[model samples]
Target: MSAGVESLLALLVSRGGGQYGYEPVSQLAHALQTASLAEAAGEGAPLVAAALLHDLGHLVEGSEVERLARGEDDHHELRALRLLKREFGAAVVEPVRLHVQAKRYLCAREPDYLAALSAASRASLAVQGGAMSADEAAAFIRLPQAEAALRLRRYDDCAKNPLAQSPDAGHFLPHLRQAQAETRTAATRPDSPSAQTGATS
Candidate 1:
């Protein structure tokens, strides 16, 4: 396995046992559940991998309790996306980066979405920037991965159920390795028209 993949697995094993902020499930459980949901939805490996690692930022930051205690947004999406970009293709990383924005976009477009959020999610929504403005939603929809991010966002929101059953975290090894290979191959194709522009395109 690549170093990045090994490191991520280790981190999940070591630090993801903690509570997922105020959620009823553990962080690891949430990740597994999200991946399970994505897989069940017929998403490909890249998306399933993205679903599994979406909240890795919270584990890396190691301060959810503290951040929420101080009412900070935490911005775990950026942290997780940074590390994801180092080892995974754009397909696995873009949704991680945009899932938060997708949440805002959904709230702006679907008023009922706000009411369905857990109390903690609702609280974080305020700090993460309340609902998006019409212009913001329009721009967000233009992103190539916006729909994927939205799908990931929905998985994220529902993955908090403590009663949900999920495969062990190790089950994602195939997906992660596949994503890593895709990233490594893409990095060598700098002149390719389909090559990523080194941003969340």
Candidate 2:
């Protein structure tokens, strides 16, 4: 794997806290579950990895209040995306930014969507401006990565399984290593040749 991707993946696997409230299902575990679900649902490696690594900013930045009080930014998604962009480029960062918006949009547009949300999500929805008007949601839908963002949001919801999902966390380290290797390989491919040759025969 490329050194950058490898390093980033290592950081993510090691740094992630467990899911928001439950100690048994860590952030890393949640990420692994999300990635696995995305893969099963036919997402590509990058998207799967994106799912796995999306919340990593929380680890680096700490909780929102702590970060803001410290005079640093509190938005974990932005911090995580900034770090990833420096390493993996925009393909990884775009979805990370949009996932939060997707959640808000879903809450606004899909009447039934809120019913499926976890308690934490439900509580945060209003704080996140959940009462946004239809016009606000429509504005969000116009973003370029809206669909992929929605897909990631769906995977995020499915990642929560306090009992069944806990076991899978054990397997995440190896998968993270493999993903790092894959990222490295993709980064170093012969882009110049492909760009110059047009379509390879």
lDDT top scorer: 1
Q: Estimate each model's TM-score.
A: 0.90, 0.74
What C-alpha lDDT does candidate 2 achieve relative to the native structure? Answer: 0.66
Each candidate: what lDDT?
Answer: 0.86, 0.66
* TM-score quality measure for candidate 2: 0.74
In candidate 1, where is summed lDDT lowest over 10 consecutive residues? 186-195
Model 1, 82-154: lDDT tens digits are 5676677778888999999999999999989988999989888988999999999999999999999999999
**Which candidate wins on TM-score?**
1
For 106-130, candidate 2 gives per-residue lDDT tens digits of: 8877878889888766755655556
After superposing all C-alphas onto the true structure, candidate 2 shows an RMSD in angstroms of: 6.3
The number of clashing residue pairs in each candidate reads 0, 7
